[model samples]
Target: MNTHPLRWDALVFGVLFALVLVGWALLTYDLASVDGLAVAGLVTLIVAGLAGIALTLRRTS
Candidate 1:
């Protein structure tokens, strides 16, 4: 049996990264001011993507 973190981590990271874009678009609305929820969601998306990238690049050897 073989265990490698790379096998599943990449796919999951990619999905999360894609979801961030979708969340950003959906959260935006035309109005006088954007809601706090939208802003917070955007921030969360960015952090998640960056963290995912870092995790993926970590040495697996």
Candidate 2:
């Protein structure tokens, strides 16, 4: 029986989604420039990739 309630994977994914939503809102409201949003998106992708790799490794080990 599993006793833990908190799901780390879901939490990480939710955080990433929230970041995308925030960036989109900023762009839509003209609070951020397109270039800035692009950079932020790139950074987010990198972070997500790293997180995925780490999670995979953790699961395997």
Candidate 3:
């Protein structure tokens, strides 16, 4: 039998992409205010930073 390692990078990219799409949809529908958008942007940045750190740690290990 053969096994393959999980693709964490692709998973992270997909999650981030989904987050952006959701934000875009909220803005399009006027469901989110300016402040909400700002918060979402900040959250996205934080998540990206964390993902970068995680990937780095994974590579080092």
| Candidate 2 worst ten-residue window by lDDT | 12-21
Q: How well is each residue in 1-61 modelled by candidate 2, as lDDT tens digits?
A: 8798999889988987898899889989999998998998898789878988999999999
lDDT of 1 by residue, 1-61 (tens): 9986676678867877786666566667432234754676688779978986888889553
Name the runs in model 3 displaced over 4 angstroms.
1-3, 47-61
lDDT of model number 3? 0.87
Candidate 2 residue pairs that clash: none
Give a tens-digit lDDT track for model 3, residues 1-61.
8898999899878987888888889989999987988987898799879988998999999
Regions of candidate 2 where Cα sits further than 4 Å from its true position = 1-20
TM-score of each: 0.41, 0.60, 0.61
TM-score of 2: 0.60
**Shift in Å, residue 18, candidate 3:** 0.2
For this target, which candidate reaches the highest TM-score against the unseen true structure? 3
What's the lDDT for residue 7 in model 1? Answer: 63
Please list the Cα RMSD from the true structure of every candidate, rounded to 1 decimal place. Answer: 6.5, 3.6, 3.3
Count of clashes in candidate 3: 0
